[model samples]
Target: MNSEAAIRAAQNQWKHRGAQRPAFALPTQPGQESVWDYPRPPALLSDTRTVQVRAKGNTAPIANSVRALRVLETAAPPTWYIPKQDIDMQRLVELKGQSSFCEWKGAATYWAISNASAQPVAWSYEKPRSEFAALQGHICFYPSRVECYVNDERVRPQPSEFYGGWVTDEVIGPFKGDPGTSHW
Candidate 1:
């Protein structure tokens, strides 16, 4: 089957699985961000700051840049997409044979960072939909697979496997990826 077909099959399986979402901590402090405040259908915002991603097991930064964009959606944290020019191209090797579909962004290509222990740490949309054209050639890292930092502050991975939001002190939850939030 084609990649899209495979993805659909997997999603269907996940829907059919007999599992309930679990309860999680909803700790929030003043001045932090709340996912409830984000917009629906998501909004693409310009984030001008130093963004960096390091291998999960390494201290050295594998990708870093000041030019990046952020996507904010209701019930989810922000996901940053760094420009190709500012990223360290040498460390990220492209992966093949898999793709993901986002209603707004279009298809995505995966990238693996090369460190002493590197895997597919990020993904990019070579040709984003015209509405999201700014994201073209910009890569987004998976926080669970790699450590992401914004302006030197390390980020927390979003709670779910499908959502790749880099949660920082500024953003609040209960965010997506947490137990029982899949339907959110």
Candidate 2:
């Protein structure tokens, strides 16, 4: 099959469509949200909360913004996409030829910090699918590789290296990307 057809087949194989929380999902308290309650194909929502990204051991943020876009998909923590304008572009170097495909979004271009190691620390969808057009010109960081904060609260990296979701106090989950959840 062609890549597009393979992606379509992979998309259809997901067992959880986000319509309801699974039996193993954690219950949310007031002011909290269950990732399971998020929708399939995801939702792109504007966020006004302060989002900040800093290099490891660096006090200054390389990217900071209150005008972020949050991508909320089922069984995963929310991924924050900062506007390109808010990022210090001079400090980032795009890793050419390193890319990935997302069934819901499209192709992603990876990036690394210029003075840091060559490992990718962030990614962006330069040309997202029509449904996720707002994501263009925005970038998302890997919390595992950098310090990330949401409204001043530090974030935890989602459980797997394959996913870049940011876990925070307000979001609860038996999140996708955890062990044995490849089928999610």
Candidate 3:
């Protein structure tokens, strides 16, 4: 089977089985959160909070949207996806690179903004799977590359380059992509 097929089968298997839930969710207290509460196979939710991504050294945001979507997955921090309409498309240049496939979201392409701001600092799924249809034509930025903010709180990039989860002060984790978290 192809990678996509394998991923779907795994997703279906995990979806039905009651497992992968973190034992410790760090008590979802006021001003604090844990990644354990997030779901496996991930789920998308509409975010009313303002999301902004400022190009490096730029005072103004190159991308900003109030109607963004957040992908919540178990063991990972939330990834904020901004709508295409919210970004300055003129400053974006889609580069050719090997794309990635998400079990839930289908295929995603790499992206970089123009003006020599950054290279491959973001990605987008132009036509996502039905489960994430809302994300079509939307791009999710890497907090590590650009200054990303959600509702006035600056975000920290998820530990590594692969998973694009945004880490805020509220979300606490020995999050995925960190050293020795490969088993997770």
Please report, in order, the local distance difference test score of every candidate based on alpha carbons: 0.75, 0.93, 0.81
TM-score of each predicted structure versus truth: 0.78, 0.96, 0.87
Clashes of each: 4, 0, 0
Which of 1 and 2 is ahead in lDDT?
2
The pairs that clash in candidate 1 are 33-170, 33-172, 159-177, 160-177
Candidate with better TM-score, 1 vs 3? 3
Write candidate 3's Cα lDDT for 20-80 as tens digits.
4456435566877677767776779998998999987898788889999998877788999
User: At residue 104, what lDDT does model 1 achieve?
Assistant: 59
List runs of model 3 lying over 4 Å from the truth.
1-4, 10-25
Instruction: Tell me model 2's lDDT, rounded to 2 decimals.
Output: 0.93
Q: Where does candidate 1 stray beyond 4 Å?
A: 1-30, 57-59, 115-119
Ranking by lDDT: 2, 3, 1
As a TM-score, model 2 comes out at 0.96
On lDDT, the stronger of 2 and 3 is 2
The sequence of per-residue lDDT tens digits that candidate 2 reaches over residues 1-184 is 3277887896798888899778999999999999998998899999999999999999989999999999999889999999999999999999999988888899899999997888999999999978999999999999999999999999999998989999999999988897899887
Tens-place lDDT per residue, model 1, 68-164, is: 8998876678899988887778887888786777755678898876543445678888987677888897899999888899999989888767778
